[model samples]
Target: MHKTLSSKQLIINEALRLGFSDIGFSTVEHLAENEIHLKEWLDNGFHAGMSYMENHFEKRINPALLVEGSTTVVSVLLNYKPKLEQSDPEAPKLARYAYGKDYHFVIKDKLQLLFDYIKSDIYPDLEGRMFTDSAPVLDRAWAVNSGLGWIGKNTNLIHKKLGSFVLIGELIINMEIEPDTPIKEACGGCTRCIDACPTKALIGPYQLDSNKCISYLTIEHREEIPEEFKGKFENWAFGCDICQEACPWNWKARPTSENEFQPHPDLLQMTNDQWHNLDEDRFTELFRKSAVKRTKYKGLKRNLDFLKKK
Candidate 1:
């Protein structure tokens, strides 16, 4: 006779089969500790220009509020590390996360499939919703609560096995499942991410001032790049990855197995001159389905121009 698998085990097996790096479950409740930290961050205006962060105050920390009757938060991690790097060393850099198709869609689609499996094959009456980074959810907090990983000093989630090159997604459902134990913080005494920041964005351990973040300046900030940051960008024409790159845990990160996360061949081949000369047509062609499209052709050109001016 075969031993029976628990509902949690069944879900975990299905999620892994769907290509998620790992999955964990947590009981849904008010994230009281995280609330205090979030309030402090917001009080300091650390969220910068993203005023939407101020909205959905209560729902952000309470999964039950987002999905009525929700009792479990199923968190999953997907590694996005790439085996390839830009071929031209002098070319403006893009963060590894943005090298492929937008993760929001990729992760959400996978989550939906997981949810469907749970509802159709496991819990026929299961009612839940899935989310990537496309919501008011505290993704890292939930991931931590689910024992997925610890939030690193640089604020990225660092899985001991997968490192910081992972993305997070979630499924909040009205079901009770055994919760996993939270992992211990692992960045003891290491401040490589802080010291590596070209713009001093990581003001202190585990504290980031988004206004000074290169990733924010390049991708999120709608205004022109601030003059004070002129030379600090280090030729990053889009998102920056200095902090993650500096994290020692990521030194041994294996490349992701997801084909959807692979960079376009032309993207890796573009030289500095080619990037500088990129026209709107080429930009569209290269980044048609990529996360880089978040920064439209004009924004990318602006970033390129900023690098040239240095």
Candidate 2:
């Protein structure tokens, strides 16, 4: 006779089958520590133009408030490591995460499917909401609380097995599950990520000033690139991976198995000329399903122009 699988085992198995690199569970509770840090970050205006970070102060820390009757927050990590690099080394660089389909949609879809499975087959009356970075969720904090990984000095979730090249998604449901213990901080005198930042975005260990972050300036900041940051971008035109690339944890990262995360042939072959002459039509065709779409054609051109000026 087969032994019945516990809800935790069932959930973990399904998550792995869905291509999640790892999964962890956490009880829905207020993130008091994260809340305090968030308040300080906001008070310092470190979020830059991302005003939405300030809108849901309470809901951001309380999982129960986001999903009524929620007791469990299941965090999943999907690795996005790239198998190939751009053929032209001098071409404007794109972040590894934007090489393929937008992860917000990819992870959110998986989370919804997981939600449906739990509701229909396991719990029957389960009510939950799936959250990617698209929501007000403090994804790293939740992932860390769920024992997914410790937040590194670069502020990315660093898994012992997968490094930090992974996307995080959460499923908050009304179910009690075994919660994983939070991992202890592991940076331990390592400051490679901090020292690697071109613009000094990592002000200190685990602290970031978004105003100076290359990823933020390239992807989120709408205005002209700040003159103060001239010659500092290092040719990044989409998102920057300098911090992650410098982290020792990422030295052993394996490429992702998800084919949808593969970089397009055209994207890999793009030269500086090709990127400079990128018309709206080609841009639309190449990034139609990519997270690079968030920057839009104009924003990408802005980033490219900034790098050109460097």
Candidate 3:
């Protein structure tokens, strides 16, 4: 057994062993280019009610500011594509990513293991923080900078081999490492994602207006859904996957091996009537560890009511 390996190889092997689909490295630096796009998006009120997007503006653009002394950014991907979907087509739909346990818990655990490995096995003095959609990290931007994939027209990080059905995470460390180069954009004029957005949320290629996004409306928006957009949700009661489902690259996505990512048996068998009749106790029982809990019972019931309205 090779007891010692280069820092890069050690990190890659450890990440893969921890079930990460792929990993890439980049030097920690200011994301000046993405800053302009982010500022424009915020200025356009595209973030809607997610005020956190406006917080930590400087840290979001420059990772070094978020993690002092960090000189390398390790980006990782975890595939969550489901092998099975909700059985009842008429049941209010959920984004495939929400089929099972909350990803923040699952991915963060594995990231902690990786962090421990770096300290115990590779570098005893290492210090950093790992994030998986829980912080102000520019995940997609860093993933692109790490050369794992290109930002698709839909603004998803599309890996050539893994498609867009994956979650991205990051580990920023103080150790400098060789960085990867960005991949070329491959959307090639495809407008399927934009054309498929029922609410016209994908205002244009690479641009999204969260105020009109189903995922944002059902999961993040606290107020009553706008009446103008009634009947356009396409039956989605939780997060939506219309954009990823419409993308060509997603056709190549494979089922995830992580058991935690598989749908609960109850989730698969739920009928429209069952969802309509769901009570708080049942909601808590089923979604105790699921990302679907993000919307909570009241929010979910709101979505159901909107979908079933006459």
Over 4 Å off, model 3: 1-5
As for candidate 3, its clashing pairs are: none
**Model 2: pairs clashing at backbone N, Cα or C within 3 Å:** none
Candidate 1: how many backbone clashes?
A: 0
Candidate 3: tens digits of C-alpha lDDT, residues 118-232: 9998888899999999999999999999999999878889999889999999999897778889889889979999999999999998999999999999999999999988989
lDDT by residue for model 1 (53-166), tens: 999999998978889999999999999999999999899999999999999999999999999999898888899899999898999998999998899999999999999999
lDDT values, one for every candidate: 0.91, 0.90, 0.92
Q: Which residue runs does candidate 2 get wrong by more than 4 Å?
A: 1-5
Clashes of each: 0, 0, 0
What tens-digit string does per-residue lDDT give for candidate 2 at 1-310?
1222476788888889988899999889999999999999999999999999999789998978878899988999999999888888888999999999999888988888888888877788788888898888999998998998999999999999899999999998887887889989888999999999999999999899999999999999989989999999888899999999999999999999988898777899899899998989999999999999999999998888888783
Error of 1 at 234 (Å): 1.3
